[model samples]
Target: MRSIWNGAVSFGLISIPIKLVNATENHSVAFRQIHIEDGSRIRHRKVCEVEDREVTTAEIGRAYEDADGTMIPITDEDLASLPIPTARTIEIVAFVPAYRIDPLQMDAAYYLAANGVPAAKPYTLLREALRRSHKVAVAKFALRGRERLGMLRVVDDVIVMHGLLWPDEIRAPDGVAPEAGVTVRSKELDLADVLMETLGEVDLADLHDDYREAVEELVAAKASGGEAPSAPVADRTGRKVIDLMSALENSVRQARVARGEAGSADVGADADADVKPLRRTAARKRSEAASEPPPSRKKPARKTAAKTTAAGGAAKKTATKTVAKKAASEAKKSAPRRRASA
Candidate 1:
């Protein structure tokens, strides 16, 4: 909580004494250069080219280098005597909407603390004013011998100042975007929307740096004389998609599966699984129709009637043949009896 700078915020006629402290810190792992062959620590010393000797910190000073390779030495007294109010004060230029500040212009952040009891009232007043107006105060302050633009806004009960780069410092994004001839289809956008929704809004606090954690683990393992843990490698098929429509369909299904939706299979596992839901539904309907028996038609009914008539005629002819055979057998028996009588 050490203050880097002690300055006063000039708000109209009100001067609020505040202490500037960095709002963020670097947690990344630091590495030192070493001699690989000797396993010894490597050191770099600040040496002057003209003298060809190492110099102490007190001997070093600031200078501006010109295009002609000439160094123009600048003294501390010269910088302090500069005719600018921002040299020792944060002078508010104007109050503007916070959205007017471009994110690309944002740099380091700091929290402004009221220096003493006398500054508390004015500090709180400015904080409340900024909160009520829903705007930020654009200010100019000198830090590290250079004046920088800053946007002042209220964070909770504290007044936070975010360092902003000058408009001229930002480069125009001319060739950063894709060429004009390329385009995106509505279908692709729909899939992208689904993917975004599937990922959803995440709490930033729940996230952490995986690489940093791994590095820490590796260092711990080395210190303990233990085997370093190996991270699992993902198995990628590296298959190039030939059909965008199918790819989008599979992506939607995969997203649904990831969101814990029921009856969703991992279509990414099967190369042939790239099927649209609408097309699948239509195919299912067609298969169901094919499986069911056909309906009774008028032509089928007429054919059945004709078949019944032919069956009746065949039965009558069979009956007539049977009666004629019986009459012939009786005549044969009578003739045999007459022969016996004679």
Candidate 2:
């Protein structure tokens, strides 16, 4: 990458020579204006409105208009001779905790590198110091003829300079935030927390510009003489916007569903209450079936077939024996007492 600015970082009496390279870039496609009638490129010309004639680049000059509409031309040479201390050096104004700097103030970033081998030591020292202390250096520098406020910090072991918006440049967020006295419910907050929990951790790598991709697709289709893609359907469902509490609750419920949890905000509130009993009854049945002994695992019964047969046989044998003895005695008695005495 080409270095855009050559400057030095100044703090106290020390100056570390550094070269600045733009940290970010745009990947957007550029479109040129064309004539719809002839499909030809459209060209614009510089013209003098007062003279009604064409003007060249060399004839153009920067000018300031007075309150009375008097135009006073300012020469490029006049503006170039002004004293700008920030032009050659980025002067450190203060070293403050990184968190103290608002992200809204950041505008553009640049990668800082030592201009030469000799400047590397001091650059490394400052980078390490910022990394260890977790601090950002508020600095001032001039770029493109404008003096700019900036923050210098270490990003991924490399020192970076970010141009910051001026105090007047940042608008108060009072108009952007919710109106005062518009209270939020604890229930709503709880549901929002649940939604956040369901959302899980953020990974910026997963985020992308779908609009850019769609634009490229549209261009490709048009270039190939194919049918143009249809526009995306706008969501007119004000369900979320109209009811914050309900929306948060639904979001939480949907996230739970995604995570395979039991929840349905759209369903009745008593739905859970009704579901629990069925779950319990099913669980109880399972437990009862588990507790009951298996037929194969049971001990033999007291009235089993073999035991019943043996008992009946024993009773019959005793009865028959008794009857036979009684009959013998009776016959003896009937036959004669004399025979028994003999």
Candidate 3:
């Protein structure tokens, strides 16, 4: 994995030089905007709001706007001069039990690798300590001009850091979650328990992304033959949701069928139909041949150059003839004066 950032894990006085790499990546297939009828790719441009025209990077600048609508243009120099220490030291503030750090507070995950041989020993020491103690080090660091809180823990025999949200950043769930006074039947709870027990502990890797797989299959099937597949219509007949007890019972039955404990669940007519994954840099280099006007096919040839030289020759000849005519006229007038003197 390519290291995105290079820094040190400040374990007290010892700095374990390490490089940070992203822990995860999105594998979902992405689709771009395309015209349906023509299959033409639609390109987007960065247009200036005020100018109402497309603008290039050279025309753009970063700015900070005030509450009063005042925009202060900022530069790279300004960002570099921010008060973050140049050392890029990730300070281990404290070690607390891993359970103390809420998963909701975690933002992004990154893996840290020792930069060199010297840092390896200290890095291993910290990793082992955290592993034995069942604790995660709370780290404080600055990245991209912002102070960040992170939890450092040992994962897969390597040190991983989860970027954390500040206390104020984590919003209160006061009004979001429904109040727990809703009556749930004991029977429903039993069914839920059965479903959970049946499923047991699932390895995340064992699960298949059915939607994505179906989408890919549909695309492949369509592409194989020129025939465009018919779109699958969603079941939106406005069916009323069944009672909670019935729903729980139905879910448990389905789960049992999926696990092969019971008979197969009823399949619809379009059950086998592939559902195409519904997930939806190149500088536009002007193709010289296409973008430019085809080289003037009627280019002035070498014959044109010869014509120009001939035209110059003709002009020179005309000048010589005029000079000769002037000289003859002077000679004729001088001859008459010479005859009168004789």
Best by TM-score: 1
- Model 3 over residues 188-209: C-alpha lDDT tens digits? 5555666677666889988888
1 or 2, greater by lDDT: 1
Q: What is residue 128's positional error in candidate 2, in angstroms?
A: 1.3
Alpha carbon lDDT at 147, candidate 2: 85
Best by lDDT: 1
Question: For residues 201-305, could you state the per-residue lDDT of candidate 1 as single tens digits?
Answer: 879999999999999999999999999999888655655576776677666667677777636345335655446553334444555567688986988889999
Which is the winner by TM-score between candidate 2 and candidate 3? 2
Candidates' C-alpha lDDT? 0.87, 0.80, 0.78
RMSD list, candidates in order: 17.2, 18.7, 34.3
Q: Model 1, stretches more than 4 Å misplaced?
A: 262-264, 267-272, 278-342
TM of each candidate vs. truth:
0.77, 0.70, 0.67
Q: List the candidates ranked by lDDT, beginning with the highest.
A: 1, 2, 3
Provide the global lDDT of candidate 1 against the true structure.
Answer: 0.87
Residue 102, model 3: lDDT of 81
Residues 174-292, candidate 2: write the lDDT tens digits. Answer: 77887779987544555565578777886899998888888899999999999989997975453334366555655666566777675465343432222221122344455556667
The alpha-carbon lDDT assigned to residue 175 of candidate 1 equals 92
The runs of at least 3 residues in candidate 3 whose Cα sits more than 4 Å from the true structure, single-residue gaps closed, are 35-38, 47-60, 226-242, 263-342
